[model samples]
Target: MQIDIRAKGFELSPALREHAERRLGFALSWAVYDVRKVAVRLYDINGPRGGEDKCCRIQIALPGTSDVVIEDTEADLYIAINRAVDRAERSLARRLERQREHRHARQPVVEITDDDSAEEFEQRADAGVFH
Candidate 1:
């Protein structure tokens, strides 16, 4: 997946960029095929004031599904990123599950075969052939 990391209101350090990249790479590895791109934005809400205003926002792009967004705020940017990534993982799982369920529901539950008799085919069609 493509990852775009940006910092707002503060200069992004190499260490911070590496940390975010590594964290997301490991966390979302299971979704490698499903996830297309990820954009992470870190914000220093208070800037110099510095109170628990660090924010991490992550937006994920998936094929055949709506994008997923997750955000977290904490005293430290690292913590915010960690929390946001965790939430994004859960949200992505849920969205993928819903997508699978929708696709499954739309498919026909029974298939016709040439070996089947007319009566059997009708019965199978009337009441789906469930395993």
Candidate 2:
């Protein structure tokens, strides 16, 4: 997966970038096949004031589905990144699970007998016309 990291309101350091990349790679490794790209935005929401204002927003682009976006805020940037990555992993897993369920939930095809057509059988079943 292609990962893009952006920092706002502070300088992006090599150590921070490496840490974020490593964490994201590890967290999202299971979804690499589905995920096309990942965008990570780190920022100091409170600026020099420093509170629980370090924010990490992660957006994952998946093929044939809506992108997953996760945001986390904490006092430390690493914590925020970790939380956001974890949330992203969970969200992606849920999405994939739902897709799999939907794919498997399709109605089974039934062969029509000489006495009844498929449509008629369905209609009868809908009208509670079982024999």
**Number of the top-ranking candidate, with lDDT as the measure:** 1
Q: Per-prediction RMSD in angstroms? A: 4.1, 5.5
TM-scores of all candidate predictions against the true structure: 0.84, 0.80
lDDT of 1: 0.92
lDDT of 2: 0.91
What tens digits encode model 1's per-residue C-alpha lDDT throughout 22-125? 99999899999999999999999988997999999999999976799999999989999989999999999999989999999998766567788889888877
Error of 2 at 38 (Å): 0.6
- Displacement of residue 107 (Cα, Å) in model 2 is 6.7
- Which residue runs does candidate 2 get wrong by more than 4 Å? 107-131
